[model samples]
Target: MKKYQPFLLTILLLALFPALAKSEVPIQKGERLNLSRCVETALRNHPVVQGARDTIRIGESRIGQAQANYYPQVNWQTDYTRINRSRTGNSTYSDYNSSVVLSQTLYDFGKTKTSVNIEKLTTDSFRQDLHRAETEIVYGVKSAYFSLLQAEKNRDVAVETVAQFQHHLTQAKGFFEVGTKPKFDVTKAEVDLSNAVLNRIRAENDLRIARVGLVNALGIPSAPEFSLDDSPLFQKEKIDLADALERAYRNRPDLQSIGKKVEAADESIKLARKGYYPYVTGSAGYGYSGEDFPLRDGWNVGALLNVPLFSGFQTRYAVEEAKASLDVLRANEASLRQTIRLEVEQALSNLREAQERTEATRVAVRQAEENAELANGRYDAGVGNPIEVTDALVSLSNARTAYIAALTDCRIAQAGLEKSIGKRD
Candidate 1:
């Protein structure tokens, strides 16, 4: 992925362009990707998303390990020993014993249960982590997608404005040839026309950069050309900040992950506490010991209970460690909740402010258009200086650009708000 300085101080920017955004190529006619398609493809193919999937699978594999402790352990042993005693006068004997001994923990006061619970919680935590990763990827994709769209639209506007300025420049020169307009007017007109061409060139470059950004966001191989499906992001909708914040708290996958972490820590505390209790085990075995040709058979079964008398305060320290882990998780959860609240509030404000700015900028564009027309008429009728016309033209172009910026801001803010809400995929 190409990186660029973030002039917008937001989530999107790039360098290194495909330069083929508008180039003629036989597009392979792949399925056009919208937000949903981008998200689906990213979930399936993105490295981060795939890595998260692997973690969840590991979590699943660990459940088997957690359950394996419940099964009995059986084994066989065989050994031969040579005995020589001075009293026996150099006599030697061989003894061998072989048997299958099965041993299982009868009880540990819910230790296994607690451990299983912790493992299950860990599995759930990773699932939420996957969801969080997918959410972030979605935001990245949306930002790049909208950026490309806006750049293309801006390029179209720049091209049209250049054509208009060139027509005006031609009219200015024709008037000059007739010995009516002054040379200064023709020079100013040419300068404006060149500026318009410069704007078009810049817009074209920007569009290419935006295309590179989209390609990176999609996490696909570098492509010469890619087309996104046309899908408008805007829709009129009412937002209830209160409800949204509440839902975000419940649904945000990162928070849910912390909650699971806390649960696992709690279970760990229980498992550690189990160390203070007695460990009970049941065992059964059958074996034969022979000193001669005939075989001696024997069988034994017993229950063993072991109480931790003292282990240099190991159990106590382990329980304390578990408690400390839980405390850390609780503190982290509190901090995370506060951060989520701030993000949601900021994104909401940005969206509403962008909405207002879009309206104001729309009016500004109309005003700038009127001002440009008035200046043009005044200049043509010999009541305005060429400088005044140039100023008005510059103002008009700036107003149009600002209007586009406001629209782009509104769309991006909306996407960001959805991210903050955590209901987005």
Candidate 2:
């Protein structure tokens, strides 16, 4: 009976805590985030992207507020008062009034229209800003993805190097035991093997850090341990400088945002200049006023005109400020044009340099591998020294490292070029 009770308790516990029985690391089940998916995740989760999207909403709200000026305003009011006209006997009486008033702007010399246009342009500018943010996140994710891939490749190379050194160490010891190699050969091989182990450890640490960077880029703090799909190796892409510059000029969202701002500023200038003209408004009211209910009733309607004769130079200063603001935007547009040109030149140069480096290192990797293989064969055949093998191994390791670096650089530079040209999400 006691054994059955214990078994029943265990069953209850398992039923209550089923998740506790699951494996912690079961076959690496995690999402495989490709480049496009990574970019999508970043755009969805990144704070900057979210904030930019919120800015568009804010701009929309502003546009609504500006359009509100085009509509009529209405209000209700009631008042009660006691008055003595001459301080005589029975001279005080109660007066009651209630009214519903309506007011509408009949004309304002296009001020309301200009304001609405400015708000609309502002919203467009914010939209462009959002686009720019999305573009930036896309590039950021690509760069980080490439870096992680490079780290993984480097780690693999380190593992291979370690294994090769271990093989060389075993061979050296065997030769020493057979009296074919000296003790010095075995000692040198041991040192090289130890160095390779250290390098492997460093490479592994780098891979972990790279993974963290990729997660940060994805903006997923709690992302699972996932593998990335390897991007294709770099191929030389021929991009014309003139065409790239043109694309940047046409496609850059930041530039477009500034252009919208300039247009808004032009509207602001017109809005400010409207202060010089007269404003005319129409109003109407319907009311009942008496000491008691249903005593008297009447309605009134009228129009009012206001001229800005003197405002302490406010209009003058506002016009000056608007003109100055427009000038500033124009200057910024010019500066941005220069900046775009420089970015295009720099990206083109970097892409060209990376392409050249990758090609050179690709050949170097093949040659170094051959050299290392030859050295290993000679030593194994008792025709070479341990020093030759160690040197060749180191050369091969360095060559592989350079090749990986070049590949990463090329990929990162390509992403940079895409960003500089304002590739849309």
Candidate 3:
């Protein structure tokens, strides 16, 4: 039993090891988060970012492999054999052989050097890919952050509308009790209150959905119930289209990655062309051999010139393939540049439209608020009907919602513009 206890403990510890290693700090209930924190969290925790980092490591390893030819290779080998001499009365004998060899490349007409350069370029491309991943995550976080803020604002407006309707219903009931309003007014007010409650319910559900979106964007879906601090500010900034385009071309990681690939492809062509040249290698070996007792020892040194007379056009085809790949990469680079231009233009246009709408809706909300107040006052003074009050309140609610939407759009548009211009911050 005691022996089994140790085995069981070992098994238990092994089982728990994986869980402990993979455990992440849980988000506390009601934790407050802002946009910058969300972006940082996503960058640190997202699988896409981690995968990109792994890709860079792989490229770095490949660079080492390409550089390995610069160093000597050492190897040791051993062999034993038993021989039967049937003609000599079936006599048997054993033979043993061992050797240590050191080989190094003397020259390859810049083949190894070009390969190393290509690998370095490839690693640079992987680094750019990592940057691109982080940029995308940042943009996603920003978009989700703004969306959640919008949902919160809309929900607030819904709650306010419900409160206004409840007040109106109470006023209608009071007027009816005094015989100043008809029963129809009381019934209408009840119906409007019910609709407002329903809208509030829907708004609350939408807010929950927005919370889920933000959690997903943060790459922390297991996060507990948390609160976001609203911080949407609309500020106008001047942007030049030409300058934006230039920045995108200079800073976009995907474009830079492709450019590195193009350079690697050119180096590939050079490496393939070197296949037609001769390679010089030097090797030295020490060996021991014996049939019995002490063995005889010997050492040898030699140089080899391996010239490629022909290879069924393999070298020719490799060069051709490298050129074709280069052409494809160039075409892709051109296409990406065009797409970047369109993205920047569209982002700018959307931002302008959203800003204009925000201004318009801001004014509309103020007017609606004033109109609603006047209508409610008129009803209290017994000069306005229930319909006027309802209409004014509905208009006010809609104006507030529109203003929220416009503000959210402006924020999202600004994020889009930043992404298009390759601004990671």
Candidate 4:
């Protein structure tokens, strides 16, 4: 029981960790997060995504205003006038008038249709913008997740290196007592052990920073004692190259977003051109205006047409502005398509390289393990020098680091591919 004191203390401290206020949401400390869950959490919680959602609602509301032409416009008014008693032949009489007026456009020369089209197109552009935000969140979360994993592995390596040097120091001290070696080896080992301890601290700090990034991505607080659960991130299925390319061309959100923007700009040009045509509208109003004719309250109906002969050429300038915008968006869209292809190409290339490296690194890790074991056996048998053992350990460390790096590179490449191709979830 005495030997378990530290373990018990650690458990007690963990139990004392503060929990979050939201019960439906997990207390963040000790939470296990993977790419999918992290992305989902971010999409649901990130402030940027929420702001984008608000913009979508704004677009939706504006669509109603653009479509309001299809419905009648109603106006209400009430007024009272007091006149000199002799002016209108009525004395001390309240001259009050109240009326409701309604007007509607029975027809317009494509202005209403084009305006509605532009608003709908604008809404579609925002839909793509939301997709872009979601994709960005996924990529950011993944990068932070991988960084944390690497930091953990680095920490483990540092600890193992420290233990190796401590063992070396112990062996040197024993050999020196037996009068078989000098004090220099022991001093060198102590120095290496101290450096390894420093390395371990740095790695731990790196992990903390990475955790902070992940917390930010998830819109949660940092400083959680979270355990990792990445069982899902490694789930893989082969993607047909042609299908991937097709999907990239079709579904890449940023590109689709640009495409929608170009369409919206085109719609704007049409909307602007609509002002060049005459606007024909039908209108009707009914009220009471009785001087003395049967104390009459009655109905009236009429129609009107509006044509803009000139207005400082504002409408003409607007058309030119819309056309210029259309031209610019078209050029930008062409550039975007090329950019998408380049990304797809680069991600494909990196993934292939990482895949090959993974296989190579797997073989290297195995060979290094064998070498380290042989070195250890030889050292115990007094047939190996300290330098040989250190070299073998170093080789093992390099192999392990390389293997982890290969896997990390593969995962990062996969993420880039996913983003390039717009693979949702």
lDDT of each: 0.82, 0.89, 0.91, 0.77
RMSD for all candidates, in order, please. Answer: 10.5, 5.8, 6.0, 7.5
Q: Model 3 lDDT vs. the true structure?
A: 0.91
The backbone clash count of each candidate, in order, is 0, 0, 0, 0
The alpha-carbon lDDT assigned to residue 159 of candidate 4 equals: 80
- Candidate 1 per-residue C-alpha lDDT over 159-219 given as tens digits, one digit per residue, 9 for 90 to 100: 9788767867876888789987888778988888898999999999999999888777767
Over 1-425, each residue of candidate 2 has an lDDT whose tens digit, in order, gives 88799899999999998777753422134866677778877888888899999999999999999888799999898899888868477577788999999999999998899999999999999999999998988888888899999999999999999999999999999999999999999899899999999999999999999988888877776677898878544544678899899999999999999999999999999999999999999999998899766659889999999999999999999999999999999999999999989988999899889889998999999999999999999998899998899999999999999999999899888888888899955
Total backbone clashes of model 2? Answer: 0
Which candidate model has the greater TM-score, 2 or 3?
Answer: 3
> How does each model score on TM-score?
0.83, 0.89, 0.91, 0.84
TM accuracy, model 3: 0.91
Q: lDDT score, residue 133, model 3?
A: 89
For model 1, where is the 10-residue window of minimal lDDT? 8-17
Query: What is the model-wide C-alpha lDDT for candidate 1?
Result: 0.82
Cα error, candidate 1, residue 207 (Å): 1.8
Error of 4 at 51 (Å): 1.5
Which model scores highest in TM-score?
3
